[model samples]
Target: MLDLHNHTTRCKHATGTMSEYVDTALSQGVSVYGFACHAPMDYDTGFRMSFDELQDYFHDIETLQERYSGRCTIRKGLEVDYLPKHLDSRVLDADVDYLIGSVHFLDDWGFDNPQFISEYMRQDMSQCWQRYLHAIRDMAKSGLFQIVGHFDLLKIFNNPPDDSVHEAITQTLESIKSAGMALEINSAGLRKPIGEIYPSKQILRKAFALGIPITFGSDAHAVQQVGFGRESAQRLAKEVGYTKMLDFHNRSPIVCRIP
Candidate 1:
């Protein structure tokens, strides 16, 4: 199995060290395990690693990669939040294995935060949904990321908007396809209150129909959670007619069989 979205204590919200996660991946028999901790933002968010700590983050991952050389492939990546003008350009220019673009905030208001759920509720649900989709499309079209993370994270509250957002969803998928970026079938949602994978079955079907390549991510925050829910993600992919999943190195995709 291959899992590209994982977190470490550097992300503040997650637990475990890079070595611990690597050991867990080895135990899970994961063929390729990536440490994609939240990328450092220019300002303090208290959730991501600070810019000053980014070098050490890279060093730690590199050290682990050498330490576990022949046992399993360990990659270094970042779960970069797309904030339009706010993102540091250096992150895109960083020498990393890959980048996972995600939208955790809707213009500064973190819609996925449990503490911010009340704030999300105060907005017009329909408009908020549309805006979230737009942000995703913009992120895809930006041409900076290799994969899109948690495709429908705005539904974190379990209160989905009406079905009138079809056009927006279509555009987002099309943008991802046109950008030649892969979409992650993230399993972290199962741990959330929503209790389902990100990008839901509906979105996954649309992405499959659009010919967008897919990848698997456990989005694990702890050592024990590494490769969590991969079996369910694989079944979902096959049900949607996906025959191959993507693996990345130096930001280039390598096709792998869906097993």
Candidate 2:
């Protein structure tokens, strides 16, 4: 199985070494594991590692890649926030197996963060979803990423988006398809207040009908969290009629049959 979106201590908030995470993945029988630590950006300095730490991050992943060569496949990746003006080429052009583009902010406000969740009650919920999906559309159009991380993460706090945002979701998924990007079925949402997988069953059904390729990630932040909810994620994918899932090697998707 493949679990491609995980973080390390470099992300500031996540705990554990890269090796510890791999050990957990191995214990869970994951054949292909990846570390997509939060990419450094000037906007969120507190949560992500500084630009200078990029070297060490790469070195650590490379070390794990060699150390786990035969036992399990290790992929190097970066989870980049799709902030238009703040995105740097150093990260966009980083040499890694893949990049997971995500939208965690609407302007300066991190809509997903509980600290500013009250803002949701203040604004038009549909407008907020539209703005977030528009960012996803632009991120896909940029051709800078291989996977879309946590689609519908705006609902992390259980702030449901109204049907008014239907067209936006359709357009965003179309953009992802046009970009040849795969959507990650992130299980982390199950651990969050939303208590559902990323993209939701509704969105996943739409993506399936649109022929967008699928991938899986636990979005693990701690060692014990590695490969967490993997079985449920696989079950969800199958329920949505997905028989194969995408992994990556050198930023190119490698399709594997779901077992």
lDDT of 1 by residue, 1-259 (tens): 8999999898888887778888887887888989898998964468899888988999998898898898988888999999977689668888898999999887778778787777954788789889998998999889999999999887777856478887888998999999999999999888888889887998899999999999999999888888788889989999999999999999989899987
Clashing pairs in 2: none
Tell me the spans in candidate 2 whose CA falls farther than 4 Å from its real position.
none
| lDDT measured at residue 99 in model 1 versus the true structure, 0 to 100 | 98
Which 10 residues in a row give candidate 2 its minimum summed lDDT? 112-121
Output the number of the TM-score-best candidate: 2
lDDT of 2 by residue, 148-252 (tens): 999999889887668888888999999999999999999999898989889889999999999999999999999888887899999999999999999998899
Q: In terms of TM-score, how similar is model 1 to the real structure?
A: 0.97
Q: Quote the positional error of residue 208 for candidate 2 in Å.
A: 0.6
Give the TM-score of each candidate. 0.97, 0.98
